[model samples]
Target: MKVLVLGSGAGGGCPQWNCNCAMCAAARNGSRLIRARTQSSIAVSPDGQRWVLLNASPDIGQQLRLQPALQPQHGLRDTPIKAVVLMDAQVDHATGLLSLREGPPIELYVTPCVFEDLTTGLPILSVLEHYCGVRWHMLPVAGEQRVAEFVIDGFETLRFRAIAIPGKAPPYSPHRHDPKVGDNIALEITDRRSGKRLCYAPGLAAVGPSEFEWMQGADCLLVDGTFWTDDEMITAGLGSKRAADMGHLPQCSSDGRPGMMDALDGTRAGRKLLIHINNSNPILDDDGPERAELAHRGIEVAHDGMEISL
Candidate 1:
């Protein structure tokens, strides 16, 4: 199984257009320690020929331009992207679907609640229906039959299971008051042939015993690293909202409570990486103490264009 890190930054990305925060400023100045990044998204492939996008960010056009493999070749309209799997209905994760309207019909996989949210709240599907055909697949997130097996490029079969993680609905949704079973989820994908497993959860709000169990024995685990502390936004004076309120469990907590880093400190996973990083996160600075701390704990910070094979 191969995975490509298309974009590593959270919403607004590094060097956000309007902000002049330290990290963003550093990125704008071309500081080596602070690299510019786009909104979070990834591509997975069983074989190099065909790819499935994990999430399509608003920066998909730029992200695709950087990936030659996804570019057109045989014909004017040919593309390697075969499908897209959405983890949630957040704008950062789903807005790029609009950019793909010009491409050929694409399959989209998402939980039923997410499907409804996109159709009713955002109305993305309704808008896209006029431009191109979308084959929507219902992603199951509960019960013993949660795994959805599908063939990739007519050669390899991969199984994916969406595990419900603690998170609230997208802020723009009219049904935000009614959070459903699949408001947010972590995806566990396994290569049926090689048995390699990968777990991706870039919007994690909280990690409980069940969530930890879901990540056990994976070959690679990519998780949320949106904020260094719960009050990161407040401390940086970027916003009044806490990281927890934004649906991300910080790497560390200000109240001496265990955070994401502490929970994965001694995990058995062969590889653990932090993705979907926010511009305010100190870990984005290579020379920062937080980066050193993560390295010491055998964790890595993922960056755009990173490729991993398992």
Candidate 2:
């Protein structure tokens, strides 16, 4: 199984336009330690030829351009992307579906809640229906008897299940309701033939008992690292919302309490990486103490174009 990190930054990306925060400023200045990133997204392939995008970021076009494997080669419109699995309905994650309108019909996997949210709130499904044929499949939430199975061109056996994580609906949703099952989720993909597994949770709010149990012993675990500290945005004077308030639990809490890092420190995953990083997070500065701390703890901060083979 191969996983590709297409983009690693949060919503607006590392050097967000119109923001002059220190990290963004350093990135704008071309600081070698600071790397610019697009919004969070990844592509996974059971075999190199057939790929499935985890989330389609707003910068999907640029992301695809950076990866030659996904480029057309056989024919004028041939593409390696066979399907897209959405983790949520946020703009950064779902807007890129528009860019895929010109491609051949693609399958979209999402939970029923996410499907409804997109239909009523963003109307992405409705709009895409006009552009191209989209085969929709409902992703089975955690604990469901059935799992979503797919047959990639070159894979022997593969299946995926969605594990519900604690998170609320997107802030912009017309229906501002409390967190519910399917509002946010993590994906666990298992290659039955190879006995390798990967868990991806780029929008995790809190890691509960069930969530941790689901991630145990995975070959690769790519998790949320949206903020370094809970109050990162406020401390950076960028926004009033704390990391948790924005549906992401920080790596470390503001009061020095244990956070995601503390919780995931000794997990048995073969490799652990942080994704969906916010621009204000100090970890973006490669030389910063925060980055060193994460390294010491055996956690990697994912970057664009990173590839993992398991």
Candidate 3:
């Protein structure tokens, strides 16, 4: 199994436009010690020929251009992407669906809530209605959804289990008035051909009991690292909420509490990585103290262009 963990930054990406933070500034100045990134996403392949995107990021075009395998060779019809596995309905994660509009109508697997969001407000289907070869498959949180020979098992995120801060909810739904909803999922995909497993959760809120079963067994686990310390934005005065308040449990939390790092380090999974990073996170500095701590825990921070074979 060949897996490509694409863009690894949070919603605004590392060097967020119009931000003058040290990290962003250093990145813009081409400092090797600092790095720039796009919104988070990943791609996997059973044979390295038929690729499946994990999420359609805002940076899809540049991401595809960086990967020769995904580039179309025979005009448009020869695109390699076979499907898209959506993790949530956030703009950064779903907006790039348009990048593939000219190619085949790719299979999209998402939960009911996400389906509603996509259909009612964004209407991704409508945007690609004229694009032949598109397909939409409704996937659920607790059941199996199959695509080709791959068996995809989904687990719900802590969107409902965790509280959403006032005025910090997704800009798309201000009232938060959906009938029955929450940010839909995280996924554990297994290739029947290779018998290898991958667990992907970019916008993770927290690691709950229900998700442990898959996390403990998967060969590779890509989890959220949106904030190195829970109060990152708070301390920086860039935002008024803690990482947890934003629906993402920080890499480490406040109240002197240990966070997701502990959960992942204690897990039995062989390969573990942290993704969906915030620009403010000190861990983004490869040689920073926090990065040393993650390394000491045997955790790998996901980086753009990083590849793993299972």
Q: Tens digit of lDDT per residue, candidate 3, span 1-310?
A: 7888779998889899978777787788866376778889999877777777888998999999999888876664688787787877778888899888877667887656566667776777676787764577756442242212234222211011111111122446432443233354666666665666787877766666655655786678898888888878978878898886776878775586668887787788879899998888887888778888899988888999998997
Candidate 2 per-residue lDDT, tens place, 1-310, comes to: 8899999999999899988999999998876489999999999887788889999999999999999999997976788998899998888899899899998876888887788788888888888988886888887663442234444344456677777788768866654465557777788888877889999999988877777787778889999989988888888898898887888889985575568897778588888899999989889988889989999999999999999998
The lDDT of each candidate is: 0.86, 0.85, 0.72
Deviating ranges (above 4 Å) for candidate 1: 142-155
Model 1 scores a TM of 0.95
Q: Can you write out model 1's per-residue Cα lDDT over 59-130, one digit (the tens) per residue?
A: 999999999878886776788898999989999899999999998876898888788889988889889999
Q: What 10-residue stretch in candidate 1 is worst by lDDT?
A: 143-152
> Which segments of model 3 are wrong by more than 4 Å?
30-32, 73-76, 142-169, 174-182
> Rank by lDDT, descending?
1, 2, 3
Which model is ahead, 2 or 3, in terms of TM-score? 2
Separate clash counts for every candidate: 0, 0, 2
Quick one: best lDDT, which candidate? 1
How does residue 5 of candidate 3 score in lDDT?
Answer: 71
Residue 57 CA displacement from its true place in model 2, Å: 0.4
- In order of appearance, the predictions have TM-scores of 0.95, 0.94, 0.86
